[model samples]
Target: MIDIPDSDRQLIDQAIFLPMLLTVLQRDLAAIDKGSFKLKQPYQISIEAIIRDVQKDLAAAKRYLHKNNIKIIRGRSENNFTFYMVMYKGGEEKRSYFNDKIRNNVEDLLDYYLVGRQEER
Candidate 1:
């Protein structure tokens, strides 16, 4: 097993999950814009705010990865698992995740960024 520093692992995770979260939020924003909600403005505003925050975090993660000579590439998915290839420094590691687990994780991140973080402010 390749030992990866916790901080690098976290940045890598953000690199993977943040984009997914942003994509989901963008889709939700589009739905809110088109849906016949009586008060769509609030929902749209909330989602837009979250989107901006996620984009900032994503950009930071990308910058860190580049600066540290790290690369993450999505690999083929099989059955219930999705694979990722992480290359850092001179070492490479392959990681696999269950598809449903990925969805659940991204959902958790979305909730944190959208509601939990906002509550802290």
Candidate 2:
């Protein structure tokens, strides 16, 4: 199991939740792009919806971070392992914090939510 600080779980949760959420959206968008079943517009529409919803999720996450007395740095997912950018900070130096558990847990969630979902394979 991965080890991480409890204090950082909030941050980790932010990281994990959004990516997992987005990946599922991306998969649906990909299917839409493929014109697999429905009209070609769903892929584009789903992606657009996901993008808009991401803003909402980020806002909720930002508020959650504030309520927990932690500063939040926002990042946009860019399809890289290091996809997120620094948006803000609260109490500690960004370098002073790290969480592999959160990372692995996020990977697990993404895999489950993305690859393990129903697909037309």
17-95: candidate 2 lDDT, tens digit per residue: 6765577667767767776675677558646654565656667776766665554344443333332233334233332
* TM-score, per-candidate, Cα-based: 0.96, 0.38
Query: Would you list the clashing residue pairs of candidate 2?
Result: 71-90, 73-88, 74-87
Cα displacement (Å) at residue 112, model 1 = 0.7
Stretches of candidate 1 exceeding 4 Å from the true structure? none
Q: Candidate 1, which ten residues in sequence have the lowest lDDT sum?
A: 111-120
Error of 2 at 47 (Å): 1.3
